[model samples]
Structures are given as C-alpha cells and as structure tokens.
Target: MAQNGSAPVWWKDAVIYQIYPRSFADSNGDGIGDLPGIISHMPYLERLGVDALWISPCFQSPQGDAGYDISDYRKIDPLFGTVADYEALIKEAHDHGLRIIADMVPNHTSDQHVWFKEALASEPGSAARERYLFRDGKGKDGCEPPNNWQSVFGGIAWTQEPERKDGKPRQWYLHLFDSCQPDLNWDNPEVRTEFESVLRFWLDRGVDGFRIDVAHGLIKEKGLPPYTERATMVGEDDDKTPSNAPMWDRDGVHEIYRAWHKLLASYPGDRMLVAEAWVKPLSRLARYVRPDEMQQTFNFDYLLCRWNAAKYREIITDSLEAMHEVGAITAWVMSNHDTVRHASRLGLKDAGARPQGIDAAHEQPDEALGLRRARAVIFMTLGLPGSATLYQGEELGLPDHTKLDRKYRQDPAFFRTDGKEIGRDGCRIPLPWKADGPSLGFNETGELWLPQPEQYKNYAVAVEEKDPDSPLALYRSLLAHRKAFSLGLGALEWAPERKDVVEFCNGPVRVILNCGDKEVTLPEGEILVASHAIEKPGFLPANAAVWMTEKAE
Candidate 1:
C-alpha cells in the first residue's frame, strides 16, 4: 500500500505468505505456536519480500477441527492469544509494510455457539429450529440424511446433534463440516445480519481483508431432500453437484457479496472478501471472482495438476483462458496448508520411489539438472497470472512430511469410520528458522505441533539464505522479478518445434522450459533469463530454461 493511503485493501498483485499459526513459531515458550510467535517472525517474512500474510483461523474454537470450529465469531481462542494481541499484530503488520488478512468462517460456528445451544433447547418446529438446517425424525426416515452429500474429511456429512430442550435438551443441529461445525441457516435474514456484524467487528478493527472459509456452504436449501438417508446426504466429499443450478449459482450469493462490498466500501481501502469454494473446472472456479463478488478466489485446478511440463503448460493455458474478465486477474498456487507441499506433490519424496519417467529427483531426460530445472519452470509459474500465494516454508524447499505417527495424529478426518489417508500435517510443520536449532527454530520450549523432517534443520533460512542456488534465494529473486512486471501478463505459447519445450511470450518477454532429459535447441531469440548453463548462451540443456525476447532480426 502507498504511504499516502491511496492503496486498496485487496493487496492486488502482491504476494501473500500463508501462516498456519500452530506451526509458524512459539514466542511464549508454550509448546503450541501462537500470535506472538508469528509476530517474532515478521522480520523474516519482510526480508522474504512478501507483501501480505494470510494467517489461518485463530478464532475461538473447540479445537475439535483445529481452529476451523469457531465457538464465537468475535472472540479469540486462548490457544492463540487475546483479541488485543491480534489487534496489536495487525498494527505491527501495518507498521512493517505488510497487511494481515484473517480467515473468516461464516458458513457455520461450533455447535457450542450460543444460538445453536439455545436452538437445541427450544421446542421442535419452533422459530429457533427453523434458524438451522434440521430434519424431523432425522428426516425422510430410514436413517437417511437430508441429501446425498459427503463431508470433506470423510463420513456422512450429517450428524444428529443431541436434542436439548430448554429445561432438558432435544432437536439435532446439522453440521456440514465436523459434527460441531453446524451450518448457519443463511436462509434466515437474522443469520445474515449476525454475520454482517461479525464482519464489521473485524473491519472496524482495521483488518485489511478476509479469507472466507467454506464460503459456498453458507447458503443451502431450507427444505429437506425428497428421499435420502442422513448418512448419504452427509457423505464426506465436496458437493460436485451444483446446488440445483437455479438456486446453486443463484443471484442470492452474488447479492451477498455485493452487499458486503457496499458495507465494506464505507470503510476506506480495497478490502478483500476471498471465497474458499471447493469448486471444480476453471469455469466454475471463475464464478467466485465475480467483479462485485470477490477480486480473487483460489483456482484449485492449478493445484491438482501433475508436476510435468505438458500438464503444467495446459494448466497455465486453462487458467489464463478461464479468467479473462476485463479487470479480473489470475491467481496461482503450487502449495497451501490444505494440500501436500509442492516438493512432495511434484513427486520429490526422499524415501519414496521415483515417478515413471522422472527418477526420484525428477531427473527425467529433460531434467538433466534435477530440482534446479523444476525451479526454473516455477520461476515462470510465479510470474504468471493473478497474484501468487506461497505456503510457509515452501521457499525453503520443504517436502511433505505428512507421514505421521499414530499417536501424534490429530486429524479428525483420518479417523473417519472408513479409514485413514495421511492428512495434511506434513505441509503444516513449523518453520525451520535456524540452521540446526531445536524444532528447527520453531519454539524455544515445548514440542512442535508436527515433527520437523530430519533434513529440514539444514534447509532452514540460516542455511539456505546464504547460498545463491538455494531454493530460498531463488524464490527471493523470482519474487522480485515477478513484482517488477506490473502487467503480470503472459501468453503460454507452445514451442513450434520440439514437443518437450514449453514457451510463453508475455508482451516482449518469452520463457522456454525443456521438459526432456536431453538438450534442447534454442529458438531464434535473445536471452533474458536462464536457469541452467547460461555460460553458453544459445543452447539449453535438459531441465534447463531460458527467458527471452524476440531476437533483433
């Protein structure tokens, strides 16, 4: 943002460093990471050149589903810090030239929310019951849930909350996420107004923006399904089926966003209201970024692609083509707190077997130089559409160490009745701030939320920051280069000759990446950036890439 206050709240074209508070750092010597812990690392993030930081949910919660289960909208979770500590953080972030956009969970609150408790206490069929998504006799009978839907973590999405009648306790509350994370009855105007007040509370506190959680789940039908078991309706998977098209992509959601825009517009700055819709297809993903809705939304498409040249290029093309709205820019992410880190997702597992064509290090025919080659491709990735978001410790080249021990595991989804798949605890490990410090410099005392992969101690900032070829240094240079390009526009032009080459021309700049193990012949062009073997200008080796502009013919 400009010192003159002309800058917007969107943090447009700026990089956001996502911090998972429980793992970022610990300042109070409490084994768990906290707000003050994150504050201590501000300087590291500053030197890293990120414009803003997106901290995951730190709101008051039962801690059942981590911080996602909010027991109170405006209150702070003691596990993190007090509300004043958070306010001080926002102030500190501003002073350090960084903005803090917090995680806002509006879809639901913990079943412990006063309203839910009161609703549970109220008589059946009363106005209170209508305030939530509930069913009679578990709805449609036969133990069927409201519909055929699954939970994201696993298991049927619906759970019959303990019916509690005022003096007693009776009537179940429906939770779309965990049993405790009951969905708010957005159909009610009162629910809408309640959340609006929550919005104003944070906005009034001078928070820069909000990363809305499960934003799509906020609006669900008021009526129960024609026929379905509660378990089936609550199956644990994203609702791939659009919410009955008419009501699904209805004007209601758009109206919600537009209304927020107006309310937020009253406050100065370009405040952001990013949605976390687990939607699919670039087309569907584009809907959340409606000019009036949200300036930006996550494109899960890029995150799901294979770590290969051909697929990567296709993803780039799809992203650019999908988000061509007049003022709407593109967003790219290789890693996040929710998914496996790019290193492991890209198949760079140290103990794991090699990918088909590429060996353990992705040393395929085109990648003669191993990870260095991939980093070259990533340079172009970071420079492509919208603003790029980097997960914490990604720049240090942290691999997904999600392979957790049975006892240390806390993932609720992993314990679902069906069974367990490794959860995302790997990517959420504490930052390795020092070369060989305890918990990789995460905390002064107490155990880390997750174990630091043995090798991470060497991969810490203290070690990698000094080495030019280190991932950290490379990311630093790449980010600076990306920020230098104000347009942030590029056309992923395919190479005319070789199939292994991926070439993109953005304005006058061109980037070529060789995906094969063998050397690649250079197109007739002038070199601007080269990842490997720049010593000999024209020709590029396997896994090599070069930046270029049209040669002065």
Candidate 2:
C-alpha cells in the first residue's frame, strides 16, 4: 500500500466485513439469509464504516457443509435468492460505496454438482470421472481406500465412488472435506476452464473481488502420497513446519493462482482475489500473494497467536515483513464461519491452540473478561499496516453460543466426530438485529436455520447503538480513526520504552496494547481511543489498548 509509481489499490486500506450469509439476516421469512437480506443491510454496513463486504458462498448448493459444496458455480442458490436478487445486491452495495467480494470455493464442488453426478454415472476411466480424483482401491477386491489420508472433517479422505451401471466393484474418489464435497482435479484443463468462466461470470455482474476458500488446497501432489502426519484444522501438520502432505499447500498450487491472476487482470475495476490459505510460517503464507498470484492472503498466524504481547509483536513483524518481500498487503482476520469466536476464546486461562470446536455445552467462558480482551485486540488488529476483516457479530462482542443443543448443530464435522467436536455451530448462530423478536429480528418467522441464543438479545444492534461503550460503538470509532489516521496505509515501527507490552506507531498514531498483568504507564499524548476506562489517567491497566497522537512540538 505504501508503494509508489502507481495509485494504490482500494483493498490496501479497505476494512472488509465478512458476512456468513446463513446467519447475516433473513428476508422472506425463509429462516435463511439471502441476497435481498444483504441488500437491506448495506446501509447498516455503510454506517458501520466498512469499505467492502465479502459474502460467504451463496452459489447453488445442497446444504452439505453449508454452501461451500457449491452445485452450480453460475447460479445463486435458490435458498438464498435468484440471480436477479444477487445482481441487485451488487448494484446496491456499489451505490453505497461498499464493494462486494463473493466467496469462490474452487477446491471442490458438491457431489450433487452436475460434473460429479456425471462422474458417478460414468465408469471409473470416463472423462467425467477424470475431472475428479478417482483411483482403484488397493485390496484383494479393491475395497480399501487408495490412501490413509484423513479428511478435514474427521474421517478418511477417500470415499467409495458409487457403483457403475454394470454393477462392478466401485472405485474411490478423493474428498479432502466432507464426502459430499469431492475434490476437483486441478490437473484437468476442463476444471481450470470452468472456474475461470465462473470468475468472469461474477466479474461481469460487477462484483469487485473474490475471497478464495481453501485456496492452497486446490492442487494436490501428483502421486497422492499417503498422509502419515496429523493436520490441524487449517494449517500445516502439527510441527509448525511444512511437510510433504499430498493434500495441502503443494507447490503446484502457485501455477493455478498465476493463471487466475491473469484472468482477474483482464477485468476492469481492479478486481482482486484474497486467498484463505492457512500455510504456516510467514514465508510460506507469503507465496499466495506473490507478484503473479493473489493480491492478499489472510494472516492466520496473527489470528492463531496466543494472548501474549511478545507473540503479538512477533507475528505482526513476521507477517508484515513477509508481505513486504512479496510487495503485497497482509490481511488480518479475527473470527469467521469456521472458527470459535475470539471473544469467548480470549477468556480461557490457557486458550490453548485454536480448537476447531468446543467439546461441550458446559465449557462456558467468562463473558466480561473475554469482552475486555476482545475489545483490546480490535485496536491491535485494525491499527496494523494492512487490510482487516470483521466477522459478523464480532462488532457486537458476541461470544460463541456454547450452549447450543446438540440436536440443532448442523456443521458436518459435528456428526463426523460423533459429538467429540461441537463443530462451528456456536459461531454460526443467526445474529440478533433488534433487541426483541421471536428470532431476535434475524427473520420475520420465529424459526431460524440455527437457533439464536437468548443471551444475544443483550448484544443486539439496537442495544449497542444506544450504548456509548459497546463493542459496536468501539468498532465504529476505531474504523473512523483508522481512516483519519491513515493507519492501514502507513508503515509500522515498534515504539521504544514499553515493557511487557506491544507498542507500535503507525504514521502519526501510537498504539499500545498491555497484554501483561500489571499496569503500564501511558505515553503522553492526546488520547485517540482506549479499549477500557483508564483507572488512572496516565496509566493503562492489564488487557487493554490505547491509541494516542503525539502532542505538537
């Protein structure tokens, strides 16, 4: 963003708000969020001070793994709305100065997708079957899966392809996620052509950008080697070092993006792509945003850091330095559809590594403590020298609904793990718009796809709108300051004389975060914002952050 010679791209300083469409807002009382619902909320987002909106997948899907298992790349899911409805949302969003970035899930398609269906109908060696990874099972009757790789959702990655019309033994097809979501073979030219067409279809409709889901997982190693190491939900295997895992972050992935970059360049309006790659070490993550690849990649390293000041500074420095090498801006994220809400996670004494889901309804978090830390972290995330994303409900300081009844959970991981993991249902609960309603104003009907926790009423937009110190208020204030101070566009340098604290300056603004247990003396300046009330005017308490401007010389 600080680079010269050409005008900076809008995304460099943009504050992107991620909306999980299933829970954002529902129109037509269908108990599901739709494009019309997002359109109605554009003014709300504009008021919130975000520059762009990245809507989670709304493509035609079978509702397995939510909308990630897209059935038709060109059509809007009937549950969300019609194509006309999506076009209207894009037009309205742009009119309000809010760019729309649609989610593109190119890693795989729903088993119900036309190609996959045809693959099932055809024999193992057919051209349709070649679009996906199909291999003969390695056993006497060829019943064993091709490999021992594990699925992200807690089962073996390979699923037996349905029997052919002749009723011979079936072959196995690779599915890195749920069985309903079959991995597409990037080696196939047809697969690449189809996705390029999908990109153009939305770009032609005025969409400004795309948030690529599983961007690093799109390509696999040619041999499909056995996966002997355990994998974290998102990143490289347990050791924090890159491994030769046949399914993730393969070198072949870069070629796919290089081609995609060319396609995006062909379109006007500076259309862009942000990769949701979870590869480790800032160096590997930086590969996603190389000059010929995506414009930005999500900084999961920062998101996964424990609540320690040293780690915070370390990751920030590492991330920025990595992006600097690639001449790309880093993107920061707090929470999203797939993870636990950071608000509640911050409350845990140990916090541990990010668990994909809570194990029990009884593992309640301390709401007050979590909200304080969450509030402080926002200043740190937004003040950094790059783009930032706000997950829906995070601005409301919404904690994960840990008490959701097991019967109501829909995330496939829950069922796959057989109750050992609760899945992402906690963070995916429908948002509370108004203070009171049968479904807390998420829909006109009393029903919702995922039930809202009763406690959400207190954190509803209406209530926060009236509270000066609410998370919503803090977010709006910080976003306003972020733009006014040119924080995201500025260079970052660590400030001196801060002990047990992460202190930095972004251009004219000095940001200080106290992650230690003791109070830290605040540097003298005009106070811009503080995460918590200053018990002593010149001192900041533990688990807080402050933004200040140096006084005139």
Query: Best candidate, TM-score-wise?
Result: 2
Tell me how many residue pairs clash in candidate 1. 31
- Residue 374, model 2: lDDT of 93
Positional deviation of residue 348's Cα in model 1 after best superposition, in angstroms: 6.3
Give lDDT tens digits, candidate 2, residues 125-214.
899999999999989878999988888887788899766668798999988889999999999999999999999899999999999998
- Report RMSD (Å) for each prediction in the order shown: 5.0, 1.9
- Model 2, 181: alpha-carbon shift in Å? 0.4
Model 2: weakest 10-residue lDDT segment is: 235-244
63 Cα displacement, candidate 2 (Å): 0.5
lDDT (10s digit) by residue, model 1, range 422-480: 55565677778786656767777747776776777777888997888788887777677
Q: Which 10 residues in a row give candidate 1 its minimum summed lDDT?
A: 351-360
> In every candidate, how many clashes are there?
31, 0
> Alpha carbon lDDT of residue 384, candidate 1?
68
TM per model? 0.86, 0.97
lDDT of 1 at 268: 73
